[model samples]
Target: MSGQGTEPEAMKIVLVGHMGAGKTTAVKALGGVDVDELIESREQRTVAEIFAADGEGAFRDLEERVTLELLADPSVQAVALGGGALASRRTRAALTAARVVWLDVDADEAWRRVARSPTRPLARDERRFRALHAERQEQYAQAADAIVPASHVRRLAAPIAALEGMPAGAKLIWAVTASADYPAYIGAGLITDRRFWPATIAGRRVLVSDRNAASHYGALFEPVLTAVRIAPGEQSKTLTQAEVIWREMARTGVTRTDVTVALGGGVVGDLAGFCAATYQRGMPVVQVPTTLVAQVDSAYGGKTGVDIPEGKNYVGSFHQPAAVIADTTTLGTLPPAELAAGYAEVVKTGLIAGGWLWRRIAAGAAPDDPDVIAGCALTKLRIVAQDELDTGVRQLLNVGHTVAHAVETVTGYARYRHGEAVALGLLAELRLAGADALRQQVLELLEQAGLPVTLAADVDVEQVLLATTRDKKRVGEGPVPFALCIEPGRALTGQPVAPAELRAAIMELVG
Candidate 1:
C-alpha cells in the first residue's frame, strides 16, 4: 500500500494564473496528456462571445458550472483554469483536492502577451485588464500548491511526469529560490541509487552522523573523507560537538570545494550544516535526513544552528543545501516513540497548511505516508524560498516553536522530545489566539497521533517566561513575536501578548 491505500488517485494538474501566463502552453508541453481548456469546451459560443451576447455575470455563472462539472470527473488529468475562474468560492473550494500550479509572470510580460488578443474579454480594457490581473495574482497565490515562474516552464515537466506515473518507491518535488534551486527526492531506497546522487559530491565528502545512525547506514557513502560521529541526543547540538566535527574536517583536509553530507536526524543536519556554512567561508552540503522530523521539517530549509543554554537554535545561519535526499525506507528502523514524536511536527505542519494536507491528516492518515511527507516538505520549501532569513512571511513557520523551544530549554532538552514540546506549544499558542474551533480540532488530531497536549506537572511558568526573553525572535525588549493561528491555513505573526495572558495560558495547559 502506498500510504493512501491501493493505487494513488490520478492527480489533476490544474494550472492557474493570469491571462497569457502560459498555462495552456505548459499543459501542452507535458506531451501525451489530455488538456481541458475551459474556453474550448463551451459548445454554443466562446467565452468572449458569451460575454458579448449576455454579460460578465452570466459568463461567470456558465463558467462556474462547466468548471465544476469538469473537475468532478475522476479521470480528468490536466486542466488550465481561466484567469478569473478561481475567483468563484465554489471553484476555489473544489480545487483543494487537485494539484494547483501557479504560472507566475511579471505585469509587463503578462500584459504584452494578451494586449492584441480580442478574444480575451478582460483584456479589451487596458486599465481593467491590469486591475484584474493584479487582483487574480493574490487569489492564484493563495490557491496554488506550487508557484513556477513563466521562465521555468520547461522544468515543470519533470515534476508533472513524476505525478503522472509515480513509481512505487519514488517521489519528487522541486525547491526554487532566487539564489538557490534543488530537487528533493523522497523514496523507499533512494540512497542506494547512484543515478539520484550528484556526481559533484562523489569525492572528498565529510559524512556527519551520530553513532547510532552510523551503525546502521554509515557505509552507504562511496568516497568519504571521514565519518564524524557525535553522541546521540539533543545535548550533542552544542558548540563543543561542532568543534569536534570542525577539527575532524580540518584533520581530514576537507576544503571548500568538497561537500558535507548530514546523515542523521535534525541534530546532525543542523550541526553539520552550520559547519558547512562556516567552514572555508561556506561549502556545499547535501542533506540525507534519516528521521521523520528531519525529513519533514528541519532538513530542507537553509536554517542551520546549535543550541545554547540561553535558548534553542540561538546561533544559526541561513545556508541552503545543494540537494536533499529523503529516504522513507530508513524510517522503519525508528522506535515507536521516536516515530510518534515526529508525527507531532507533521500535525503542526498540517495545521499551518490546512488544505488537502490537513484534510488527509484529520481523516486519520498515517504519518509515514510518502504523499504526506512530500506535501509537508514542499510546504516548508515554498516558505523558505520566499523568506530565507526569517524576516517577513517565514515567521509563520514558527507557529508552535516559541513556547516549544522554551519547553525544551527549561526541561534541559531531556524530558520531552522536540515535537512533543511543539505539540504543547501549539495548544497554548492556539489558546492565546482564541481559535477555539481550530484549537479543538488540532487537539483531537494530536491526541489521535499519540502526542502530548499539556505540559508536565513540574514545569515552572516563570522559568519558561524567562527563557522566552532569551528567544532569538525577541527584539529590543519587546514581547517575543508569537505566531498565532487565527484559523486553519491562516496565521498571524508578531503579535504582542501581555505576560499575564502568557502565564495564564501556560498555567491552564499544566492544570
Candidate 2:
C-alpha cells in the first residue's frame, strides 16, 4: 500500500479497548475519515474474515501491518484497533507516537455486546472470553494515551476534542477531603505557579522536606518558607524526627495561621503533617508530594503519623492539608526502584476500584502519567470523602496493607519498599480470601511492573505474625480487620480471620 506522501505528522487518533468496547462505533460517531475504507483500500478481507480464514496469529500480523500503515497515513485522523491488536509489542511500539484512546469497558458489558457474533474466535467460550478481555484490557490501557469509558463512548466527541486541544504541561485538579477539603493539582512545573500557594499560607510558612527532595526542588519553596531538611529514609519517619520539626517550627515562629508544607515523599508528608496536627492544636498544612506514592496515596488522606518501634504509623493524627500540589514532573528525578514501589499502591487502588483504573494499571500504564496519578488520587479522595475517619468504607483502601504494615515493622522498614511489601501482602491476602484467579492475575501484573512478588528469605515469618497482632487495625483483643480481595475491583474489608489461617497465608509468602 502506498503511504500518504509528504504530509506533516498529523495527529492520528487511535481507539483501543476490549472486544465490543465500541471502538469502531465511537470512531464512526467521531465523524472522521473512515479507517476501514483505508484498510479495505489495501486488503480485500475485513479483520473478522481474515481471522476466520486463517487464525489469531495470522490476523495479528495483518492487524499490525494495517495499523502501522494507518498510523503513518497523515490523511487518516482516527482509527479503531482490534481488541487484541495491542497485545503485539510491535503494534504498541508503533502507535506510541499516535494519539491512542482506550474505550474502557467492563468484561460483562463487552461480552453482552459481542457474544452472538460468529466471527469472533476469542469470544466463543464465556470463561475464556472474560479472561481474554481482562488480559487485553491491560494492553489497551498501556497503549492508550487517554481513556474514555464505555458509558462515555456515545459522548466521545467532546472528550476527544478536548484531548486534541489540550496542550502539554496542562494542570488538572482533584478535590481531596480530610478534616477539610483541598485541591490536588497534577501537572508539570506547578511549583512556579503563584496559585499553588493557598491564601491560608500567608504567615510563617515552614517547608518540611527530605535532603534528597530538598536538594532538587528546595529552591522553589525557599522564596516562601523556611526550609527544614530531614534525613531521607523510612526510619526517619518517627516521633523524634517529628519533634525536631516541631522544634524548628517553634523556633521559626510558625503560628497557628501559618501553613506547613510537606514537600517530599510519604515520610516527609507524614512527619510534617503530624507536626502540623499537633503543633498549636493543629495548624493548616499543605502537601506537595514529590514521589509517585505520595502523589497518589499518602498525600491525600488526612491520616498523618510517625512510626513507632511497636508498629508503623503508631504515632500520628488525621491532619489534612490545606492543598496538595502533586508536581508530576518531579517524578522524573525518582529512581526506577522507587517508581516501581509506588506502583503497588496503584495496583491496590485498582483492586479496590475494579474498573477502568484497575484495567489501566493491569495493562502497565506508566505509573507517573499525570492522568494515571490523578485517577488514583481521585479514587482515594472519593473514598476518603465518604469515610474520613477510617470507620467504614475507607478501610477498603487497606486491601494489601494489613500484612504489608507487618512486614515493614518486622523487617524494621529496611528490607523492602513499602509498595513491595504491599505487593506480597496483596498475594497473601488474596490467597487467604480464596481469590486464587485474581491472585494469579495480580501476581503477573506485579511481575510485569518489576515489583517483588514474594517475601525475602531472611524475613522472619514469626516476627511478621507478631507485628500483625499489634496492628492498629486490631480492636481490643480481637482479630485485626483485614481487607480481603473477592475479585478485581471488589473486596471485603474488616473481615475477621483466625490467627492460624492468617499465619498460614503469611507463611506462603516466605520464599
Candidate 3:
C-alpha cells in the first residue's frame, strides 16, 4: 500500500519465469536491466558458453552470486533473473527485497518461442523442455507478486510498476483476453489501499451491489454516482432485475463513459456485469467480488449474464471487466454454509489444475487462503486467455458446470446454492466418465469441505436428466457434450454420453 494511489519511486522490480516466458524481453520493454546480459557482460562469455564450460552446477554458483548482487543494488530499478534462478534457494530467498512479477506462458507457447534457439541450452528437446516448464510453475506461482502473460509484457509497463505496492504474499493476476486486459488482485487489506480500486477519471462510478455486500463493505468505496442495490440470490438474477438497475442508472444521469463497480458474489457480479455490457451499448465495469465463488471463479472471466427459465447463465455476453479486486478479508464475515458452498469451486479448480493448487487443497487449504485464491484465479485466467471465446480448451473449465446448471434449472434455482449443485454435478459427471476411483477421491474432498455430496431423494431425477438436453452448449440436439473427467489435471470436452449412462449417473446422486 506504499503511497496509496501515487506512483511510488521506481525502485527494484524483479522479473522471474521459465525460459521463453519473455523475462529478458519484458525487462527491455519495461526499461529494466537484464541480469543474464550482465552475466555475459561480466564473464565475457555467452550463457551457453558458461553452461558448456562451467556446467550447470558451476553456472548456478555464478548465477547466485551475480543475481543476488543485482537484486541488492539500489540503483537498478528492475532486473530480469536468469530463467532457472528460482531453482536457487538463496536466489529465491533474496526475492523478498523487491517486487516480483512472473511472466506466465504455457509449455506449448514457451517451446514455440525457444525451439531451435542456439542460446538456450536447456531447450534442447521438446519433452525435456515441457517437463522443465511444468516443474517451474508451482515455484513461479508461489513466488510472484503478480502474474501477467508474456504476450502482454511489451505494453504492461504500467501494471509492472503497480506490483511494487502489493502487500507481502498478495498476488495479482494481470488478466488478459483477446479483447481486453485488466488486473485482478487477490489479497488482504487491498480495500484500504486506494491503488487497487480503479479510478473513474472524468466519469463517476455507478456501484451495483446486493444488500448483503452493500451492508458489509459498501461504504468502503463511497463517493459513487449511485448505489444500485439488488436483492441477493440466483432468483434475483433476471432481465427484470437488470432493467431495474438500468432505469436507476438512467435516472441518475449515468453515461457510457462512467464505470460500473460490481460489489458482491457471483449473482451480483454476473447480473451487474450483464448490465454493464448492455447499458449504453457496453460500459466498463470493475468487479469487486465479496464472495469466494466470485473471487475464485466467476470474477476473472468476461462471461456475464443472468439465468433464464430454461437454464442457469443462459443469457450472457463476453463483456470483460476493466479490473477485478478480490479482498480475501471479506470471507471472515461469510456464513459457514456460504463459505462451504464456495469450496466446491476450489475443488473443481484444483482437480482441473492438479498441481500446486490441488496439492494445497488436498492438504486442506482454507477457502480464504490468499495464495490458493490467487493460484485458482491465475489458473482460470490462463485458461480463459487461451480461449476467450469458449471454443475449445476453455470448455474444460465447464467440467462439472453442465450438470450443475441442470440441477439448478430443474429445481428452479431456489433449492441448492450454485456450488452445492456443482458439488453434486461433479460427482455425477465423474460417475458418467466411469472414473470410479477418481470420483471417490473427489467425494472425499467434498466431504472435507462439508459440501453436499448427494441430491435430496425428493428431487425428480428424470427432470434433471431432461434439463441437460437444454444446456447452452447443445447446438443441434444430437446429444449434449459432457466435459468428462477421467483423471486429475485434464478433462475431455465434446464427449457424447449415452442416455442410459447419464440417467444412471443422476440416479447415483439421488439419495
Worst 10 residues of 1 by lDDT: 1-10
lDDT of 3 by residue, 211-260 (tens): 99999888887789999889878778999999999999999999999989
Candidate 2 lDDT trough over 10 residues, lowest sum: 1-10
Error of 3 at 233 (Å): 1.3
Top candidate, metric TM-score: 3
Cα displacement (Å) at residue 212, model 2: 0.4
Better of 2 and 3 by lDDT: 3
Q: What is the Cα-based TM-score of model 3?
A: 0.94
TM-scores, one per candidate: 0.74, 0.66, 0.94
Error of 1 at 400 (Å): 1.6
Over 4 Å off, model 2: 1-178, 192-204
Per residue, candidate 2 scores C-alpha lDDT tens digits across 148-222 of: 557666776544443432323333333434446455556665674433443323566688999999888887776
Overall lDDT per candidate, in order of appearance: 0.77, 0.76, 0.84
- Candidate 3: residue 194 lDDT (0-100): 41
Give the C-alpha miss distance for residue 24 in model 1, angstroms: 4.3
Q: Which candidate tops lDDT?
A: 3
Candidate order, TM-score descending? 3, 1, 2
